[model samples]
Target: MNGTLYVGVTSDLVRRVAEHREGVVEGFTKDHELKRLVYFEAHDEIGAAIQREKSLKRWSRAWKVELIQKFNPFWDDLFDQICG
Candidate 1:
């Protein structure tokens, strides 16, 4: 099944992804069922994270899919891994 991509800044990856998975946030992600946590890159600064998110958003959907597939070919829910 195909899933939508979500890009946002968070100080806590574990907390953020858990919120997404648990449907705690009311937004496009929760609305469209886009909670698989397919891809993410951590950054030390909020500015850098925002920049990366914006840059990735500008990329084509196909490119985003490719990027995610590089690390997660099956588009698995990665919250557990990140928390572990």
Candidate 2:
């Protein structure tokens, strides 16, 4: 996928990513054609996940890229890994 980034929180990662991949919801992700799951993290609670999403949204583009590259050096789509 392209380098454009969109950050958000979802209770169901696989379902949410599928929706994005299928362009089910018309919003930032669909608008920008950002379907790759290059980076993700798990949280114990919805509140914590939301908090982390907010924090990531506020991060500078460079910082976000750095975080993603650290976790996934090749920026591979992780959708399949989660599905199984």
Which one wins on lDDT?
2
Encode model 2's per-residue lDDT on 19-39: one tens digit a residue.
999999988899988788989
Q: Give the TM-score of candidate 1.
A: 0.89
Weakest ten-residue segment in model 2 by summed lDDT: 1-10
What are the Cα lDDT values of the candidates? 0.82, 0.91
Where model 2 places Cα greater than 4 Å from the true spot, the runs are: none
The digit string of per-residue lDDT tens for model 1 on 1-84 reads 365667788899888888877889898878987667777798988999999989988998888888888989887878778988
Model 1 global lDDT (CA atoms, 0 to 1): 0.82
Distance from true position, residue 81, model 2, in Å? 0.8
lDDT of 2: 0.91
Stretches of candidate 1 exceeding 4 Å from the true structure: none
